[model samples]
Target: MMTTAVPAPAISVRGLEKSFDDLRVLRGVDLDIERGSIVALLGSNGAGKTTMVRILATLTRPDAGTVMVDGFDVMTDGANVRECISLTGQFAAVDQILTGRENLKLVAKLRHLDDPGGIADEFLARFDLVDAGSRRVAGYSGGMRRRLDIAMSLVGNPPVIFLDEPTTGLDPEARIEVWTMVQELATRGTTVLLTTQYLEEAEKLADRIAILHEGRIVANGTLAELKELLPPAEVEYVEKQPSLEDIFLALVGKNAPEGELR
Candidate 1:
């Protein structure tokens, strides 16, 4: 008789707990993210979203609980966990003095890739930064800098990536561009865990959504599943119209061809 093997989750958390002195940041949190899927950790500020990402990325140790990335225990196999994951925090980490190409090359070289130059060029083109690759990062627009930050994370092609509020502070068009890039990453088999404040962003990109409220996940599931948890909508007389976000985007396109707020 033949048997099938069950693949381990790309990311798994069990009874996760964290604290900063007397303040509890995460309270008995548990999560599981499957391979090649995108999971959005939605939360308000101080909701422990960044803390969870840090623990999973091996940057910080949790006070209690098990965290596994690609089947490796984060605590005991921190180095192995790091090998399988890349993290881009809330802010861009690129060096202002280095050209975009240089930033990619630096990451590639640090990871000891055989052909750093080739890898740099590949990411530059992939992230739509080839034209701006030679210019110092300081001169790059907010969108361009964010793209480069993500591009640098992909230098080693880790199977899992953590993006913490990746689209924050971007104009609408730039936010959409980053959202598109995130979808592309998941399509290519990278499991992505992103923290975001935007409900619309999660609805657009996530295979599953986990809402963290005051250090605990209040809801976790597919969009429809999560919606099921909400109270039934009250009957309305008027037909439903577009959301404010939709109306805002439409207006921006019409009133500002460049997509910038004056």
Candidate 2:
């Protein structure tokens, strides 16, 4: 039988460490993200989530240990690492003065991709921004801007994406909209490393969750496995009720435009 070698993980980190002056942000952190999977990195404020992501994106140098993205060593092959990944920061990095379509074209043109105009149009239609494509991004809603930001990240169709708190500052409806876009990425076999403060977001999106606590990945597993780490829950019966999210979505999702805030 002919044999095919297994592909490397989309991202790999081993004994990673970073610090600023006296404060150590990441300490002996180790993580791996399988290709085409969505892995959530969960940590509290100052728990080094952003630091971990920055290192992965090659924006910050690690104090120690090996890090790799798409089989390229981040330390020695920074350019190759960058070529394989896109980083979408907490805030939408769109030019406020440019129309939504212009923002997408700019990223494509910057990458020297052929047919920037067509690429921009494709993303606009795919992201449901065709209607707003001509409007300056300054007038865009929170969800629309985020969609465009992510659309821009997809310009080269890089194999890996780093979304740092991708849905920050969005209303409930907008948050759901962004979540759908993320799911679509995974379906298309794009690897994603997501850092977020929202526990529910991880619960909903991640195939596996890695919790960074006390400068290390204290737990990494599926939701069921993580739940198993705690003592079994007490069994009880109560009247069933809708959560705030349920009620909010019921009243908002049906009537709003795809990603517009209600």
Question: Candidate 1: where are CA atoms >4 Å away?
Answer: 1-3, 237-262
Q: In candidate 1, what are the lDDT values of residues 100-194, reduced to their tens digit?
A: 99999999999989899999999999998989999999999999999999999988899999999999899999999999999999999999999
Q: Give all TM-scores, in the order shown.
A: 0.89, 0.89
Residue 228 lDDT in candidate 1: 42
Candidate number of the best lDDT? 2
Per-residue lDDT of candidate 2, residues 183-217 (tens digit): 99999999999998787898899998887766887
* For every candidate, C-alpha RMSD to the true structure in Å: 8.5, 9.2
Q: Could you tell me the lDDT of residue 139 within candidate 2? A: 97
